[model samples]
Structures are given as C-alpha cells and as structure tokens.
Target: MRLKERTIAIVLGGGKGTRLYPLTMDRAKPAVPFAGKYRLVDIPISNCINSGIRQIYILTQFNSASLHNHISNTYIFDTFSNGFVEILAAEQTNQTDTWYQGTADAVRKNLKHFHDQNADYYIILSGDQLYRMDLKDMLDRHIACGAELTIATKPISREQATGLGIIGCDSEGIITKFYEKPANDLDISEYKVADSLLHASLGKHVDASNEYLASMGIYIFNAKTMEEVLNNDKTDFGKEIIPDVIKQRKVATYLFDGFWEDIGTIKAFYETNLDLASINPQFNFYNEMMPIYTHRRHLPATKVNFCNISSSLTSEGSIITNAYIVNSIIGVRTIIESGASLDGVYCMGASFYETEVEKTANAKKGIPNIGIGRGTIIRKAIIDQNARIGDGCRIGIDDIPRQEGDFAMYSIHDGIIVINKNAVIKNGTVM
Candidate 1:
C-alpha cells in the first residue's frame, strides 16, 4: 500500500500517573524518570522517530516543565529539515475554560493545529507504555483496508483481558464489537467468539478460542474520522469514542504478536524494566536491528568491577563497585556504593543514598542509613533520581512490612517499591 499523504502523530503525555505514586508525585506520567537513564516519555517518542514518523506533538498537562525540557533537549536533531517535535500543553482559549479532561478531549482541544497541517492520518499513542511497534506497517494495513480507523491489537491472557479494551473483528479484520471492560464471563467469552471471526490463523482455526486480543490504545485515524469523532465527543478515545465509531465506520484491526507492554502501574513499570535485564528478555531493547532511540547523552561506558552483574542494561558513567546487581538497570552517572546489594531493581540517574540519618526513631518508615553498620539490602525496588541512601537499610529483602513515617512507601503491581529523592532514614530501618 502506498504511504498516506503527510502523516502526523500526537502522543498523549498528560496523565497524572498517580499509580506510580511518589515517583510521579512531582512530574507528569511521561516525565517520570525511568530505568535509570530516560524518562517514560522517551519510549513513545523514540518509537515514533524510529518508525520514521516525525513532526510529532506531545500533549502534556501536570508538571509539564520537566517533560517539555527533556523533549526539547533530547529530541531535537538536524537530520530532517521538515521534522520537528512540539509540546501542546493544556490551555484554555477564549472558547473553552479548563484543562483537558480526557484523551479525546485533549485532541479535540487542539483540533486547529491538526487541521491546519492538513495531515491525512493522525497516530495517537499513550506515553506511559513500553512497546516497540513499526507503526508504518500498521498504517500500510489501514490504507489497504480503507479503514476509517485502525487499531493496533495484541493477544492477551484470558484472565488479564478484563482490565483492557477488549475488541472483536470480522473475517477481513474489520472490528465489530468493542468493550472497555466486560463484567460477566459469558459476555467476555462471547466477545472472544466475535473476535475469532477475523483472527483465524488461515490454515488453523479450531484453536481460535485461545486467540483473544485487546486494543493497545494505539490508533491510526483517517483524518476525516478523527475530525468527526473528536469534534463530536466529550469522553475518551476508548471508553466513549472508538466504541461508537466501530458501529458506524469501517474500523479495522492490525494484529501484532510481539511483546507489547503497558507500564502504567508501578508494578508493571518496574517489572518491564527488570524484564529488560533478563538473560533473554521478552522485550529486547538492545536489538541492534531495532534499537530504541534516546536523547543520546554522550558519556563513557560503564565500569564493572567484581560485582555480580548480568542481563542488565547499564548506561554511561555508572560505577558499579563491589556490589551485587542482578537483573537490574543502572542509569547514567550513577554511583553504586561499595558493598551495596541490589536485585531486580531500577535505579534512576545519579541516585546516592545519604550516609547521614539520625537514628532517633525505631529503624522504620523513614530512609534507612546506608553504610556498613546500616546494612542496606534492596530487592525488587525502584530508587528515583538523586536519592541518597544511608548506611544500613533493608528494602524488599527482609520480610518487614512497610510502616508509615516521614518517608512515603508505595507498592506497585509487581511488588517493586519506590524510594523518593533525598529521603533520609535512620540506621537499620526496615522497608
């Protein structure tokens, strides 16, 4: 299929990210620093650029300064004269009087820019996901099928399908039935039946019951379809818009059987990062054939000492001393204290636990001292940027339930906890 004329994409980066808790408490969801080196926004933006789609716009809302700054500094390149990235912050015009309410509304609020550019296709993606997809292929399929809207679909586990936007399609890959979250098991089963109409394996169709698919929240909208839907909607793209459009429009489904993960929650975010550190990760970001682009901060290669480290992606200037890091990621300019222990953890850029904390209270809730006497041990945790850990603190290792104190404690879906920046703890505190 021939490429559509002048395609433009808008990445939604405005979510508050409350599920990420303390880490996102200060920044927007997309601006949240992730996996030691890059922000959450980097993944989607990188995906867009790598997929050969430029002229991208990132929509931002809460704490957009850091997100905007990172995008401007990192994503600016001189390769293409016509390629550029822009941020569309939530603002009120003389007509409307509030911040963006939802994803559809955000796009609707900025309809003028999209219309002015006269883009034929509008690709919409969330910034809080960790998946690498060649949107060009999806766009090709969309054009070939003459679809008003094309959605990226991925097969998901039956038990886990309840949380996502479940979809159903016809034999020609035209979506027919769509549900945000179906309640009854029989209805979900029926939805799966409807999905089977389009997703048959050509030579194999009997085992189609196991072939359940859900929307990835990635959409390619034919300009006219987008103009009509957003112009007539008040709810979100999935919850309100797409469900109604599929009934009246020629909506198609693009099947993708690769690794696609939504890292919207703390547990999912943490687990996906650890997945990158696996010996044979399900999601291979290091694939030389399809590497995920970043801001390209130039620094020296990481130095590994007698530390037992493996399967982890270490950015530049990360000094791993006589510590044990397994299946974890270390970000740029990070200094791992000597004799520290880490496993299945994600340490953001330049984080160092302070060596000073008054042991006035029982070794609990607050930051734990991180020296030899403090005895720090971390397991399945995420330490945000520039955090200083004291001498002796145990995180996720010992079976100590988190307690409330001066420092905050957040539990993600994968049980990976988050430590805020510059949080001070006394000696021998248990997390």
Candidate 2:
C-alpha cells in the first residue's frame, strides 16, 4: 500500500502514569503539562500532523476529559475533507465490557473502529516522547523495503540501554538479536574511541563503545499484519507483540539517527523541559514552520513587576512579582510571589487564591494566598498548578544531592524534579 493511502495511525495515550505520580494524579501522561506551556501529548500529535498524517485516533483511558478537551480545541479536523483526528475513549462494546488492559489490548478492543475506517496500514506510536521526526520517511522506508513491520531504532549509551527493547541488526538492517532490557554483560562488541575529551569523556571506565540500538516505541505495520497480531494477542507491543513478531524474522529496523528523548520517566520528563531553557536548545519549540502545536491558552502577555528575569519562557497571564526568575518556564496565569526566587523550575498555573484563603492555610500555614511564596527559592523543580508554597520553602533540591523518598519524585538523566498538577507541599518543607 502507498504511504498516503494508509488507513490511520493509532497513538497510545491510555497509560495511567503511576510513575509520574503527583502529576498523573489528575491527568493522563499525555495530558501532563510540559516545558513551560505545552502538554506531553502535543509532541506526538504535532509530529503526526506535520508529517502529513491527519487521520489519527488517540486511545485513551484515565482522566480522558482533559485529553479529549485539549485534542478537540487544539486539533479541529478539516470539515471539507474525509480525514479527521479523533479520540477513542473506553466504552462497553458487545465484545468486551472492561477497560483496556495494555497497549496491544487497547487497540484490539477498538478493532471495530479501525474496521469502520478501513485504513490500509497502522502506524502505532507512544504518546509520551519528546522528538521531531519525519514519520513519512519511516513510512516510505517501510513500503520500499516491502516489510510487514518496521520498527524505529535509535542509538543510546550502553548504561542507559537497560530498560529498552535492545536489538542487534545485521548489515542489511535486519534485526538479528532482540533483548528486552538485557542484564549487564560483555556479550556485544564495543565501538572504537575517538580519544578526544569531547567524544570519550565519560571517564576511562566507559571503555566499551558498543553501539546498541534501542526501540523508540514507534512502529509501522501493514494492516494485515496488525489484524493477524491483534487477533492473536494477549500482551502489549513493547513486552510481547514486537518481540513475538521479531522472533518470526519478518520485522526490519528503521534506523532513526536523530535527536530523540523519551519522556516516559520522571527524570527524562524533567530534563527535557530544562533542555528547552538552554541557550541553544536541543529541541527548538519556537520553530514557526512545523511548530509543535498546543492548545493556545490565549493568555495575555505575562505581567512583570520589579523582578530579575533571564533566560526563561514566561507564558501568558504569568505575573512576576518582585521575584527573580532565571532559566525557568512558567505557565499561564502563574504568579511568582514577591521575594521568591525561581531557577531551573517549570511552573504551571495555580494559586491559593483559587480557593478560600483559610482552606489553603490549613494545609500549609504561612504560605502565600496569592500563589507560590515569598522568600521561597526553587532550583531544578517542577511545580504543578495551584500548589501553595509557604513563605520560606525551597522548591528545588539541586543544592543537595538527589535522594529517593516517600514524596513522589520524577527525575531525568540529569537531576531535575518533575512536579505534577495540584500537588501540595506542607509549609517549611524542603523537597
């Protein structure tokens, strides 16, 4: 089938991110606020639209309202054309009366919808990733190679390759060995070092230059292949589906040598946002052409008071009160209280003023009713909307080394904190 004639691509947005606790408490992983103003879901959908694939169906389960609302408002399908982007929420069908079990299971449950659309191919993707790729390129490669399935692969460090579905492909790009999160071993050959401090500077201990390819959780499957697998599946694509197909030796590797960051973990999620603040961003969000689309909050220009602001993205409706903000991302309607200091923080909209002052005071005494706090300093922290911080709390914990604890925390490769929405920190507490 030609790439343009492909039926539709299914984006899996149903994962109830338990890992991103406080943030996923009220919204799905895809709906979680990211960078300064956008949600995690925007990356994939924007990629799809820009890649010339408009017929999309997002599979959703937990906290689907926010996801649904965002998709509807931001992505209005063209009325004149047959192509459309839609959301497939869980419903009680005749074949099943339960919620989706996993990634593969979710699609299997909704096979009836796909049948109605009559798509020629199925492009399956993960919603929780930060990358800019041309999907059309992958589709073209898949068709040209005449393969039943084409999986996306990217090179990663051996130490960071543990949790991924690693693969060893032959010279012709046919995958030879497949391991889902293999144990540490000297089984594979390493790459030669350039010896320069820039290339080989992870200390001499990083001797092995093994070029292991990790699955980016993106796939292009023929419709027949999808139907066959889904009809005979009880497991997910990552854990069971892909591995099972690869075992048949019919899957080909589509090597994606480009910038890709998986926001599946807390740490990765935090680091991706901070990367946007860098002087030369790894991912450029400001690209007017082929821009990453998000629901425009239509917020007025951020009001700045007597504050020291530098290298930050302060979205509309954010009020910088006599505070100092450096290398941070503040979302819509966010008010940084007087005397507060924000460094390397991603803050969303929320304030104690949303509710009765006494109600907020009961939870965290001395916290400002206006929102955020006075004399509070945040470093490498993620603050969700409407969280009230007391007068003297330090939001980010970069000063001290990273620590694992009871309060739900998400950190990326680089040590950065991910604060989810509506998360309350008790007054005087240091995270």
Candidate 3:
C-alpha cells in the first residue's frame, strides 16, 4: 500500500488554552480564528491533505461545538475515496469517564477508534500551531532509517531552547538524549546538534548562534509502536513518553528548517496574526500548491470605499467606508464607518450584520451597533467578533500605560488590549 493508504493522522486539539484567554473563552484553541480567515486547526489538516493523507482524526474535549461545525461543513470527501476527517471527543466509557489529562491520554482514549483503520504508521500532530510541512518527507525519512519512532526537530538559538524540548543527536540523526525545557543556568551543551549535522541540513553558512535542536512536537511512529508506548500511564508525550522512549527505541530525527510558530500564548497568537499582513510574511498563506482549507462561507467580496489600508489583510464580506487602517487585519463581515482610524490592530468582525430595524432599536437603547462607529481610533489591539465600538472612542492609542489583567469588557495582556467578544463600548469612551 502507498503511504497515504497505510498512514493515519491524529491531531490533538489542545486543552483549555488559558494562555490565549478571551479567544478561547467560548471556543477551543483550534477553533479560534486565524489570519482573518482560517482557524488554527486548518494548518495541520491542510498539510495532511496536501501530503495525501486523508484518514484523519481530531481529538477534542473542551468547547468543541464550533470545531465540529467547521469540520462538518468544510472537509467532505466523495463516496469512493475512503477519505474521512472525523472527530473523537472525550466521553464516558467503560474504561474511563474523565477528561483528557494531556496529549497522550487523549490519544490513548481514542485508540479503539483508530484501530479500525488498521494503519501501518501513525502521525501525531498538534492543533494549535501554524506551519506548512509535507509529512511525506518525514515519513520517508522514518522508513529509510528503519526507525520505530521519528521526531521532527528544528535548529534554534540557545536563548530559544530554554522553553522547548532539546534533543541530542549524532551526525547520523539518531536521537541520543532528550531534555525537557532545561533551566537557563544549566549546562546543556551535550544536547546541542553537531556543527557538521547543522551544516548538512541548514547549509554551511547557517548561523552559528543556532546550535540547539528543539523538538517540534511533530512525531511519526509505527502503529504497533504507538500502541506499545501508550500502554503505560503517561499523560503527556513531551513531558513523559518521549524522554522515556528515546533510551529504549530506535528514535530518529528529521530536521525541519521551515517557518513554524507555536500559537500557545496570547502574545504569540497576536504577533503571528499581524505578521500575516506583512509584505513578505514568514508563513505564506497564498501558496497555491499547498493551500490551507477552511469553512467556505459563500460570502461576497469585501467592499472598500475610499479606505487607506496598507500592509493589511481584509477578508471576504467586509464593508469599509473611508477608514484609515494600517498594519492590521480586518476580518469577515467587518464594517467601519467614516473617520475611523486603526493601526496595528486585528478586528475580528461580526458573525451577522445588523439590519436597519435592529440598528435603530439599539440606537434608541443608547447602545452601539455591531461594528466600529464613526471617528474611533484604535491601535495595537484586538477587537473580537461582534464587538460594538461607539462614536469617538479611543482604544490603545494613548501613551498611557494600562495594567495587564482581565477587566469587565476587555483584557490587557502583554501590553496589547483585547476587546472581548460581543462587548459594547459607549460613545466617547477612552482607553
């Protein structure tokens, strides 16, 4: 059988993404909007599809309604392809009734469902990451090395290795030692990649600063090996299973020097989204050969009227009128009235447009409409979906320092103001 036929992909929908806070308040991390259009889950699924792996399963637990809806509406296969993208949510069973404690536990609970496929290899992926990787290359390397388990690793600077799992490998790419998030003062030169290996993978002119090989948390394992490893009581792969398995198994490393970002924290999520609007973003969503897939809302094209938008991305079904937006992202169904100014902002637009009657009713009640009102200036902020900003509002524009914490209607995290979803700001309000 071909690689696509014998390989099954398992995407682990992350636990309550507390670091991403308000964005994950009502939805799972994978369901959170990304790049003004796609969800975080789309990146992994799209990569799998592009690599010809169609038998996929996404294990979800917390706030999965939106995720289920998106998957149902978007990834449908024909009758004869034997391709399916299914969700295996945590549930009560004869074996266990608790929620998923960690990534390994999530997969172990769903192994019965996975076994129906009778696949040869299992590729495990994370849901809340942004990257475009061809897994076929990783799988080919796994087979060529005659390895039981393979991990995808990336070369990073020593400063970046403190928070990541560092791996030690020989020149032949066989993993020898693994360290989980070593302390800053600890001496971990033993975990550093050989300079010659770096030269082979990243070219001889590679930066001398990047000597550590950090695990990318992307793994490929033989089907029986996965079953054998999960037979233990380990709850997480990185913290428990990987470190133990390296000493006993033939674990190899696949060097990946592509652009990959772990969108686990609010700051990383915000910065990564804004970077997509750059002229030459590190992660390109416009690659025609490996297109990212998402829900097709059948919305009309975005309509802009005399708006000065530069270095920004505007999604479909948006209507902008005489707004000054720069270095920002305007999401779907967004409406900006005249004289509104936005800089370094990500406005996640409304889900539905308010009709004339509804707008008039809200006006009588002294409430702002569903979109940004006139003459509002916002900078370095994130406006969540269905937010209402009244006229003459100033958000994140002043030089005043705001405390970092969750407030009634919004949050200030990492010096960036995030207006909560469905929040309403009165006219002449200043932040």
Clashing pairs in 2: 7-119, 7-120, 23-420, 191-209, 267-411, 267-412, 268-412, 350-386
Model 3: lDDT equals 0.92
Per residue, candidate 2 scores C-alpha lDDT tens digits across 1-431 of: 44564658799985778777667777877888888678888888888888888788899888888888778888876675456668898899777788888999999988888888677788898888888888898888788878898888876677867777787666556665677786677454432112342122233332334367788999999888988987774758888888778778478777665678877766777777877887888888877777998886666788899999888888777777899888888877787778989887888775223557575666565344535777888887777777656677775644667655435433332355555455555556676
My TM-score estimates for the predictions, one after another, are 0.87, 0.85, 0.98
Off by over 4 Å in 1: 1-5, 193-209, 351-375, 403-415
**Candidate 3 on 1-431: residue-level lDDT in tens?**
77789999999998998999988888988889888888889999999999999999999898999899989999999988799999888899998889999999999999999889999999999998888999998999899999999999988998999999999999989999999999999999888788888777666476788889999999999999999999988999999999888999999999888899998988998999999999999998889999999888999999999989999999999999999999999999999999999999999897888999999999999999988999999999999999999999999977887999999999999998999999999999999
User: How well does candidate 2 match the true structure in TM-score terms?
Assistant: 0.85
Please give, for residues 1-431, the per-residue lDDT of candidate 1 as tens digits: 22433788899985677777777777788888766677888787777777778778888888888777788888776874467788999887899888889999999999887776678899998988888888888888898989999999876657768788888876677898898866546456655634444445223433444456789999999888898887774658988899889998999988776778888877788888888778888876666756666666777788877777777778787767788777888877776766778887788855333333443442455543332222367888787776656666777887765553224534434456777754544456677
**Once model 2 is optimally superposed onto the true structure by TM-score, how far is the C-alpha of residue 1 displaced, in angstroms?**
10
Clashes of 3: 0
Global lDDT scores for all candidate models: 0.75, 0.74, 0.92
lDDT score, candidate 2, position 109: 85
